[model samples]
Structures are given as structure tokens and as C-alpha cells.
Target: METDLVIVGGGPAGLSAAITATSYGADVILIEESFSLGGQLRQQTQLHANLPSKFFAERGTSLVKRLTSQLETPNLKILRNHTMIGAYKNGHIGVTNGKTTFEIEAKKNIIASGAAENAWIFPGWTLPGVMTAGAAQILLNREFVYPGKQVMMIGSNSFALEVVKQLYECGISVQAIVEASETILSRDQALLSMCKKNNIPFFLNSTIESVSGSGHVEKMTIRTSEGMMEELEVDLICTANGFSPILEAFQIMSCDLTHSEVLGGWLPTYSVNFQTSNPSVYLAGNAAGITSLGSILLTGEIAALSALESLQFISERDSNRKKAALWEELYQIETFFNKDTMLARLELVKHYHSERGLPLPDFVDPLKGEMLFG
Candidate 1:
């Protein structure tokens, strides 16, 4: 079959893009790899203790329901339990459901495959009980299952801390959160207080030397900054070093990609419009870079608008107006959560500026987002 737009994910970006594109009069087909629609959204829950249930995670759940209902639109078709394998010649896409593979032609495509958890490989990481913090999250939140009785986390970022809270709630004891950095990031301060109050120790300037078990992870050896090894018993060693965008399909599409350790590894170097080096393929949401749900939603809309306009499905004037309005919404969600990301953002800007032969900026306005060139 053929469509004007094919969105390759069912998460915040893909869903929002589908909704916007159909509203703007483009026929859309959404392909989700999961059996259900919601993407990374299904994995999130309460972000902070201060916020009520109406915040990011809960709001995302509600959005999934609302957006799913909108799929009743005649122009929008959904294909679940299906995935696009690759691109065919002449704007056609190879889609498969394992047993059967077929092709669908589309004028435009938005890849919103989202982010994958970073694998911080160390000794014994391949142990049976070892898992990423994201996996632990899915087990407890979605499946109502306990990941482990006792766990120790490596990588003392906010994401890992959030999992620590959930582990406590689920009655899974978190031994300690280990950080290679000298201190926990400021963004994690709020939850750090909560964790300390609950008696979860924070290990600074520490790293896991190794884990040991016969068939499953049973204990770990941690190396402190003083070069002393501390051994502790834990059923699971969870890695929470953050995430990288799932960019394999984009790579297959031959989009220009750049490595940014700050942005979560190799991400498509798409322009502001989310257009990749390949003119027909676009990126949205975590597939571009990790950010808030609000930013992902706005980017989805912007990408859909660009796709619609590129296909001549929407008027150029309407496209420009819609994109400008959506970008303003995106800019509002732009805030540096920690110093590392902030510096990385600056580094990214410098790299791009160097690519374009422009002078590196002296300072970027944190609040106003103004760039003063050096």
C-alpha cells in the first residue's frame, strides 16, 4: 500500500506526528514494533516526589489514550506488531512481521525509533542477573514484577536515581549508587535528599571493578577513589549510564550522523527541521537526541509538518506558520538539567560551527537562548 507519510514509531514523537500530519490532510500509516501503541512513554512513571500524578509520566499515559483514540481518523492507518526493515528504491519501504515482508511506498518518512539504554560493559556485565536500569524499570512498572531483591547501581545520574526510588517502592533494596564523578549532579539533588533520608548510601568517585556469581550475579567489587576494593552482596548490578538514540535505520538510510557523547552517542545530524542528509527521511524525538516528552511531541509535529509540506500535501504558507509555532513550543522546553549536558550542548554547537566555518560562540544565554559569537 501507499501513503503520504509513514511514521516508524508509536511513541510520543510518532504518535504526535501522526496526529498532526493527519489533521493537516496527509494520509498517514503508523508502524509500531510493539504489540501496543505507546512507545517509551509506557515505561515512565512519576518523575519527582514534588510533582503530582498530572506531570510528565502520567500526562504521557493520558496522551497515549487520547492519541490512540484519534487513530479512528479515516486517513490514519496503524500497523502494530510490524516494523520497517529497510528502504526500497523509489521511496518505497520494506516492512516485515517476521514471516511476511512487504513494501509500502511513501512520499515521506519520520523515524522516531526513540532511545536505547547505554550498555556500560565491565567485568561480569554479562552475568545473568545484570541488567540495565531501564529493564529493571520495565519489570517493576509494567509487569508488576521485582527485578531483584538487592541491587547496586553504577552511574550516579538522575535517571539511575529515579530507578533507585522505584526499587525502594517495590521493596527491592538498593545497596548504593556508585558515581565515577566526584559528586552527584545538581539535577539529582532533590532526589538525593529523598534517597539519603531513606538510607540509600551514595558512593562518590567510585566504579564497579567486577561482579561474581556462579550462575547469576550475587556480589560485586567496587573500586573507590582511594584505590580500595569494597565487596558487597547484591542480586543484580544495574547499569544506568543514560541512553543513546536508536539510529540503525537512519544509518541504513545513509543519513549524516555525528558522534556526540553528550547527546547519547551517534545521532543523526539532522537540521532544525529534522531533515537528515537524505531529503526524504526525517528524524523526530529521541531518535534525534534525548530530551523531555514535551520537546519530543513538538518535534514530532514539526517533522510531520515538514513532511506534509514537502509532499505538497499542505500549502507552503501553512507549513511555515505551523513550523514556527511548533518551534517556539520546543524552545520553551529547552533547559539544561545538569552541567554535563550543558557543556555537551556547547560542545555540539562548537562542532557544528566549526563544520560551517563560523566562529565559536562565547556564551549561550541559558534563559533567552541567545548566542554571542566569539
Candidate 2:
């Protein structure tokens, strides 16, 4: 198949990019690995402080609905139950829908592939009842299948808290939430309050010493803050250590990447507009790095616009003007619930601007993490 743009992933970012590209008169083919389109958005059930959350608590599901409704243009083609397998030379992409593999010749590629949940491994983690917090979330929210009668979570970040909330809503019980770190990175009071209301105990400065079970996880040992070990009996163990960008496309393209724990592990250094080192490829959303959902949408739109411009599907002048316009529009569209996340935007821009030989933006007092232009 030959198209002006080949987008991988059918999440919010991929859908947004496809919509924007087709609106600009570019032919688009969007491929998603799942049977449905929403990606992780389908599992999420929290209200962020972003623009969309102002109107709805279930913003991810809502965005999925809104984006799909707008993707009715004739120039767009969507392939579900499909995933990109490789990126060959000369802008060719290899994709598969399980039974068959096909090649696509594209002028430009947008990798809104998003992120993958990170599970910090522990003994007995391979047991049947042990899973990632994300797995637990999907089991309850999407699959409508409960993980276990009683679950123990091994992380206390916002994501973990969200999973715990969903578990409660699913009529399941969470035994405890454990964090090895000494401090909680996210300070969302609303999330904390929800945990309190649910009576889910949050344990910090603690680590799961080991998990033991014959067929499924039945019990685990946790080292508490006081260096005392406590044994908890639980049927399911869910770990949500963190997330890393899903960089299969980058790996296929052999793009230069770096490992940044702060930026969510090995990822390509994204230019201000989320361009990877490879000229023909670009990244957006969690694929570049973790940020707010609103910010992810902005990057997706911007990346689509950039990709279209690279293919001469849109002129440079028009792209530059639109990008300038989007910069202001981005602030209006995105909202940060935690004040600390505001600095992530700064770090993304400043580092990339310097890499591109553009003037670097100025720094805030490093609150939790920077300077940027007004």
C-alpha cells in the first residue's frame, strides 16, 4: 500500500495525528495492534486537570469517542488487529494483522506508539496470579474479568492509585500499595484522598522481599520502612514500578536513543516538535516521553503537521506558521494537575532546541526537576 502518511498505533495520539493529516489533504493509513482503538485510554478512568477533564472524569474514553467520530474522512484508512513489525529502508513499513504480513510504502511515518507498563521483577513474579498493575486495570476495566478476589499493589504513584480506584469500583479488594522509594513522586491530593476513602494502605520505603506460591501468588514478604519484614497473604500481586516508551519503531529504524530514568527509560531524543534523529520518522505522545494526556495530543497533532510538511504535502511556510499557532494553542489545550510536571515540558523543549542548533530557552528553580520562553 502506498500512502502519504503511515501512522502506527490507534491510541488518542495516532487518531489525532490521522485526523490532522487527512484534514491537511494527506492520505493516511492508521494501524493498531488491538481489536479496538483506544489503547491504554480504554483502561483509564480518572479525571485529569487537562482541558478535556474539565468537562468529564472519564476523559480518556471520551477523547477516544470524540477522535473516532472525527476520523470519517475518505482519505483515511484504519487497520485494526494489526501492528507494525519493521521499518525497512526507503520509507517502507512492514505490518501484520496476525494471519498475514504486508508492506506499506509511505512518504512519512508518525510513531504515536505510546508507552509500555514497566514491572519491576521480583521472586515468584512469573506465577499465574502475579501481574502488572496495568494488567489488573485492563482485567477490571476493559476485559470485565477480575484479577483476584484480593490484590496487593506494589506501587503508589498516580497510575497505581488509579488502578486501585478502578479495582474498588470493580468490587474487588486491594490489600496494600507498596513503594520501595522513600518518597512519592506524584502529589495529587485528590488521588491520595481517593485511596484514603477506599482504605487502601500506602506503604513507602518498602520493598517486596519475595513472593511465594505453588500455582498462583498466595503470599509475599515486604520490608517495611522500619526494616521489619511483614508477611501479607494475597491472591494477586500487581506491580506498577513505572512506564517506558514503546520504541519498537525506533528499534526497527535504529534511531539514536538514550536511557533517562527521569524521562521514562530508553527513548529517542525528541526535537522540540518530537522529531527523532531519523529525518523521515517522528514520535509523539508517550513514545517520546511521559507527559500529560493533553500534552500527548499536542505532540501528536504537531508531529502529524511536521510529517506532512516533510513530505511536501504541506508547505514549509504553512507548517511554520501553524506550529507557531499550535504553541499557544497547546497551553490552552493541556493542563498539569501536579505542579512538578510543568518542568517536563521545559526539559523536553530546552534539550531538543539545543540539539537542533536553535537558541535554548531559559530555567525555573528546578522545582521537582527549568527555563522556557514566555
Candidate 3:
């Protein structure tokens, strides 16, 4: 397959870019690995703050439907269940449709492959009923199934909170919400107060020591400060350490990446136009940096316009100021949410391949504990 623009992921970033670029008369090909096209947004429970009011509290599945419908342009060709396994020089890409390899030549490439959820393993994490909070959300939203009747959340971050919220909406009970940190992180003080008023048990400065059950998770042992231990009887455990970027494409492309604790370990440096060190390639969405959908859309549109400009299709002007305003709006959201600190702590981890002379994480048993990223 060949196209003027090849988008590597069909999330909000790639989908938005495809619609905008195609409307500008560019032929576009969008590739998504999953059977569907929404990416992580399809797994979310609630839309976060700072977005348009209409999108507030919208469900992930609903968002995917709306965006997918808006993006069905005549010039856009979408390849669902297609995965890009390798990238080559001179704007060539290698993709797979599960059984066959397809080579694509592109005038410009945009990577919106996005990020992945991180799994922090502890005792009994390999149990059949154990999963990440985001994974649990995927089960509920995508499969219309619950992990179990009762769930014990292992973290108190936004994802974990959303899992609890969604599970409640699904008529499942959350036994407890445990936070290893000393305090819960939240931008909305009212939400925290509501949690307290609802009598939901919040354990701070605590950690899950182990999980145990006959064949599935039935109980979790949590160790708290003051040398106290508590066994919570729950049918499922949801570990929520947070998210990290999907960097396989960056590694294959040989782009220079660094471990920025603020950007979730490995990330590539790109200009405002989303151009990587390679002029023919661009990046957007969480692949550039973990952020909200509003920011992701703005970055994607800017990248599309920049690519058009490079091809002598669009001219730069003061009208571009709209992007700057969008950036500032996202800046306020980030500031209010305190994402900088969390991102700062995440910079401690990095990704490296054997030939790159960078040390990768030691996976004792990859299949048992590994998290897949595209």
C-alpha cells in the first residue's frame, strides 16, 4: 500500500490528523493494531477535566464511535487490526495484517502509536484474577465483563479512581482503594471530599504485600505504617502504577531518545511541528508526551499543517495562534492536575535495546508479567 501520509495509530491523534490532512486533499492511510480504532481512549471510564463541556464525563466507547464517524473521509483508508512491525529509511514502513506483510512508501509519516499501561509486579501478581486498572477498564468497556464481584484497587491515581467509578457504575463493588503514597493526587478537591463522605476506605502510606487464593484472587494482604497488617477479602486485585510510552517504533527508526522522569521514561525530542530528528517522520499524541485529548488533537493538527507546509501545500500565518492558545489551555490543565511531578518521578526508568548499548528492564518471565505496547 502507498499513501502521501501514513499514520501509525488510529487513536485520537492519528484519527484527527487523518481527517484534517485528508480534508486538505492529501491521501491518508491509518493503521491500527487492535480490532478497533480508539486506542486507550476506548478503555477509559470518564473524560478528564479541561476538555469541552460536551465531552465531560463521556464514556470511552462513545468517544470512539463519535471520533470514528467524524473521520470517515473519502481520502482516508483505515486498516484495522494492522500492525506496523518495522520502519525503514527514506519514509518506507513495514506493516502486518496478522498473516501477510505489506510494504508502504510514504511522503510523510506520523506516529501516534501512543502509550501503554505499566505493570508493577508484587507477590501473587501472576494470579489469574490479577490485572492492571486500565486492563480492568478494558475488560469492562470492551468485553462487557467484570474482573470479579469485588475488587481491591492497588493504587489511588486517576486511572485507579476511574476504575472504581466505572465499576460502581457497572454495579460492582470496590472493597478498598490503597495508595502507596502518603496522599491521594487530585486536582478536584471536591472529588476527594466526596470519596471521604461516601465512606470509601482510603489506605494511605500502604502497600500490597501479597495476594492469595485457591486458583484466583480472593484476598490481598496490605501492610500499613505502624507495623499493622490487614487482609482485604476481595475477588480481584487491580494494580495501577500508571502509564508509559510505546517506543518500539522510535527504537526501530533509531531516533535519539532519553529517559525523562517527567515524560514517563523513554521519549523522543520533537519540534513544535511534531517532526522528529528525521525530517520525513513526525510524532503526536502520547508518543510525543502523555497529555489530554484536547492537547493531543492540537498537536496532531499542527503536525498535519506542518507536513502540508513542507510539501508547499499550506502557508504559515498568524492564524496559527490558535494552536498556541490550545497549548496554554492544556498548560493550565497540567498545572492544576500536578502532572509535572508524576512525570518527574517516572523519568527514573528508560528503554534500551541490545545494539543501542542501553540496559533494558530484566524480564524474568515475560509472558507471565510482561505488558505489551505498540
**lDDT of all the models against the reference?**
0.77, 0.77, 0.72
Candidate 2 residue-wise lDDT, 257-327, digit = tens? 87666667888876655677777788878887776677677778889988988878789888877766665
TM-score of 2: 0.89
User: What's each prediction's TM-score?
Assistant: 0.88, 0.89, 0.85
Q: Is candidate 2 or 3 superior in TM-score?
A: 2
Instruction: Please tell me which predicted candidate would have the highest TM-score against the true structure.
Output: 2
- Across 1-374, the per-residue lDDT of candidate 1 in tens digits comes to 88888899999789888988998778898999889888866767754122212234344456677768877799998999998888777657788989899987888889999999989888998998899988988888778888899999888777888888878887888899999999885366667888879988888999889999999998899999899999999998889878889987887688888887767888887654677778889888888777666667777888888888888878878777766666544554544333344344445545655576755322223312432321
lDDT at 64, model 3:
75
Candidate 2, superposed: residue stretches over 4 Å from native: 52-58, 329-374
How would you encode candidate 3's per-residue C-alpha lDDT over 1-374 as one tens digit per residue? 77888888999888777876887888889999988888887877575546533355466667778878877678888988999998755548899987998788888888888988789788898998899888888899878887789888888876677677788678778788888888885445655665676667888898889999999988889998655899888897888887777889877777677667656677876654567766778887778777666667656776787676676555555324534454444444544456563233222222223333544323211311322220
